[model samples]
Target: MNEQLVLRVLGMDCAACEQRLAYAVRRVEGVRYAVADHGTGVLEVHLMPGTDREAVAARVVEAGFTVTGVETR
Candidate 1:
């Protein structure tokens, strides 16, 4: 089983910030893939089933970004 999570991230002001956040999300245990877009402020993540959304949010926070919203697709 797998889940797709698209998060709208705020406070990313540069390409480095986007890359860092994408890298952080990928570092999460259940995340299979991640793409952080600075222009759109969105992070699309493909994750394993039973993954904790809070954990995902925490990883983004650890990278100094804020998750404003989450959407499933």
Candidate 2:
């Protein structure tokens, strides 16, 4: 089964920002889905086994967002 990573990403206050962050995150290896909600500043990423959470967080930063919190399940 895939792992789900819930992240609190800042600066995604608009649809564009949300889309940009999702795009960047989806480019990361092992990510199956990257969904961001600007209203909630939440980014939910479902990834394959062995996917690196840090790498996904890095991509969020690269996309000009800040990850303030993270939880995995």
Top candidate on TM-score is 2
Off by over 4 Å in 2: none
Summarize candidate 1's per-residue lDDT along 1-73 as a digit string, tens digits: 7899999999888889888888988988989999888999999999998888789999998888888999998
lDDT of 2 by residue, 8-71 (tens): 9889879999889999999999999999999999999999999988899999998899999999
**Cα deviation in Å at residue 41, candidate 1?**
0.4
TM-score of each prediction: 0.91, 0.97
What lDDT does each candidate get?
Answer: 0.90, 0.94
Error of 2 at 41 (Å): 0.4
State residue 15's C-alpha deviation in candidate 1, in Å: 1.7
